[model samples]
Target: MRKITHKKAAAVAMAAALSAALLAGCGSTAATTDSVAESTSTAASESTAAESTEETADESTADEAAAKNCADLIDAIYVQERTADTDARCEAAKAAWDALTDTQKEMVEGENADPEYFGRDTGDASKDDPRNEDEIGENELLVVSFGTSFNDSRVADIKGIEDALQAAYPDWSVRRAFTAQIIINHVQARDGEKIDNMQQALDRAVANGVKNLIVQPTHLMHGAEYDEMCEAVDEYKDKFESVSIAEPLLGEVGSDASVINADKEAVAAAITAEAVKTAGYDDAAAAAADGTAFVFMGHGTSHTAKVSYSQMQTTMQTLGYDNVFIGTVEGEPEDTACEAVIEKVKEAGYTKVVLRPLMVVAGDHANNDMAGSDDDSWLSQFKAAGCFDSVDTQIAGLGEIADIQQLYVDHTKAAMEALNG
Candidate 1:
C-alpha cells in the first residue's frame, strides 16, 4: 500500500511541471511575433515619407520649367518682324504663346508681347493724337507712304502728318503703313526700329474691327507708290464698313493745272523763303537780285505722273520767278536733268546756286544723290560743271513745313466729304 501511494504522488508532480513549461514557451513566442510586426510597420512608414518628398520636388521643378518657357516665348515675339526669316520666328513665338494656359500667360511681364500688346499704341505719340487713347475708335485713318529707314526723319515727317490728321479728326484713330518693304527691313536691321508694313497695318486694323477707314497718303504726288497704296486699299475695301482715300500732299493732277497750282506755288514760296533765310536775304526777290539761283531737286520717276515736274516749272515761271530752276535725279521731263539745269542756270547769268530737295522727305535722294560726297553724285557733278562761283545745299523736306501739313489735312477733309457724298 505505501509503494502505490508514492508512485501516484510522483506522477502528479511530473504533470504540474509539464504544464508550467508549456505556458512559458507560449508567452515567449507571442512576444517575438509582436516585435516583428512593430518593426515591419515602422519600415513601411519611412518608405511612404520618402516617396512623398520626391513627388513634391518633382512638382516644383515642373513649375520652374513652365515659367522659363513663357519668358522665352515673349522675347522671341518681340524681335523685329522685318526679314522673312525673323517673321517665321514671330509666327512660332505666337504659336507657343497661344498654347500656354491663362496661368502661364500671366507669368509674362514687361516687353508687352501679350494679347493686349496688339493694336495698343505703346510708344511716345503726341498727346493730342487720338491713337494715344486706350479705347480705339470705330473710324480709323491709315496714313500710307513710301517709308524711310531714318528714325528721326520717320518720326518727324511721317508721324508729323499722322499727328496733324489725328488732331483735325479727333474721332478718328490715326495709324501708319509703309509701302516699301526694303525700307522697313533697312530700318529694323540698322537701328532696331520696328515699323508695320502695308499688310501688318491692315491686319491690325482688321483685327481691331475698324468700321470706317480713310487712307491719307503722305506721298508728294500720284506716282507708283500712290498707285500701290490704292491697290492695297481696294483689296481690303470690303473689310471695312466704308473705306475712302485722300489725295497726296500735292493734291490731284487730272489735266487741271489749277488743282496742283496751289501746291506748286506754296512749295515754291516756302522753299524760296527758307532759301532766302539761309542766304541772309530779306525775301525771294532779294535772293534773286543777289544772283543766287535756287535749284530745287526732285525725285524724278519714269511713271506717267512725271509731268508734275514740268507743270511745277511752268507754275514757277507763271509766278514770275525765273531764277528758281527745277531739276530731277532720274532726269525726268528731259529739261530738268542736272546738266540741262546747270546750262539753264548759266544762261540766266547766275553766279551762285542754292541746292535743296523738292521731295516730302530729304531721304536717300536728297542726302546721298543730291548732297553726297561721291564723285558720281549731283553735288559733285554740279561742282564739276564749273558754272557757279559757289554752291550751297539745304537739307530739309517739304513735310517739315506747316503749310504742307495743312494741305494734307485739307485733302483728308475733302476725301471724307467725297466719301459721304
Candidate 2:
C-alpha cells in the first residue's frame, strides 16, 4: 500500500531536508526574538502563535513531500509475458522487481499464489509459443475489466485485480479481458497493437487449448455492458469442452446484505478517508457531525446510470451517514433529489456541507458541473438555497482510488470461488 520509488524517495528526502533547514533557521530567529522581546511586550502570545503556525506548517510540508513521493509509473513496465514480443519489457520488469524489497516487488510482479496452471510457465513471449498452448488445462479462469484508459493507471486497477484473483485460486490459470470498447478502440487506432474483441480474446484462449473457461466481469454492477459481455461469451461457451461464465462484479449472488455492507464500507472509506486526511477535514469535525450533510455527484448515464447512483445512495444511508445524498446531472433520483436536500438543510438548519464526485475520474463533471459554482452546477444551486456560506469540494473519483478497485478485486475473487465450487 505504501508505494515509493528511489527517485521519489530521494525527492522527498531533499524536500524534507530543505524544510528542516527552514525550520531550524526559524527556530534560531525565534530564540533570539523571544529572548529580546520577553520583557518588551506580549512575547508569550507571539511565541505561542508562532509555535502553532510552525507545527501546522511542518505537518503540511510533510504531507506535500509524501504526496510527491508516490512515484510516476510512466517509466515502469507492466504487461509482462503478454506475448513473444513482450519479453524485453518482461525482463526489465523482473530486474526492476529483483531490485525492490518483497513488498515493493509484489507491486510489480503479482503476489498470486503462483498456482501452476496448465499453460507453459513462460514469460511475455509465451503468447506466441505453440508449447505454451499445450501447457493450459481445461479448468482456466479469465478476468474481465474496463481496462483503464490511463496507461499507467491500468497497472493497479485491472492488473491488481487479476493478481488477487490468481492468488485466491492458486490452481486456476487466470487471464484478463477488457470490455472498455472506447478505450480498446483508441489503443488499437492510435497504437498498432492488435487489440482483441471479447470473442477474439475468448477464441485466442480456446485456440491455445484452454478449456473450462470461467469468464468473470470486473464491472462495479450489472448493466448493459455486462449483458453485452455475456452475449459475447455465450456465443463461444460451446467451443470449450467445458465452459461457464461467472457473474459480473456485484453479481446477483454478491448482492446479499453483508456483502453489500462490506462493499459500501470499502467504497466509502476508499473515497473519503484519504480526502478527510488530504484536505485537513479534521478541523471540520462539526461537518461529519450528525445532521451534517454531504452531497455526492454521480455521472448520470442516458441508460443505466441511475442503477449505480441509486445503489450508491442506499449504500450511504446504510453507512449511517443519514445526511448523505446523491444526485446526477442526468436521469431520475433527479436534481430535485438535490433540491430536497437543500430543503432539509433549510429546515433542520445545517449551514455547511461538503460536495464530492461519485464517478471514476473527476475529469469534467466534478470540475465543470458539481463544484464549479456555475449557475448550472449543483453547488451553485445549494448556495442559492442558502444552505451554507461556503461549500468545499473534493475532485477524487472512486475509480482512481486503489482501495476502491480492490473492491472489484474482492468481487472477482468471490465469483471465481463460486465457479471453482
| Best-performing candidate as measured by TM-score | 1
- lDDT by residue (1-421, candidate 1, tens digit) is 5434444544454455454445556567666456545544554455455556666776666655664565565555544345557655545555555566665555545453444322223233322121323247688888887876444556666777787888999988888777776565544433345567788888788888888988999998889989988987899988999988998876666563333467667767776777678779897678788898889999888887888888788777887778888899999878889999999999999988889888877776788799889997778888998878888898777776777788889889988998788
User: What range of 10 consecutive residues in model 1 has the weakest lDDT sum?
Assistant: 125-134
**Clash count of each predicted structure:** 0, 10
> What's model 1's overall lDDT?
0.72
Instruction: Quote the RMSD, in angstroms, for model 2.
Output: 19.1
Error of 1 at 61 (Å): 46
Candidate 1 residue pairs in clash (backbone atoms < 3 Å): none
lDDT of 2 by residue, 1-421 (tens): 1122433544554455455555555467767455444423333454455566667777666544432221112122222213343434434433433344433322331232111111112123212111113356666677766553333334434555556666766777777666654444333322323345475578778777876677767665566667778888878877876666655443442343233545655676566565555556552344456334567776565444345556666666676655566676663555425676577556656666678876554544676688775797877888787648667787655655667656665665665566557
Tell me the spans in candidate 1 whose CA falls farther than 4 Å from its real position: 1-84, 88-135, 256-260
Instruction: Give per-model TM-scores.
Output: 0.68, 0.53
Q: Judging by lDDT against the true structure, name the best candidate.
A: 1
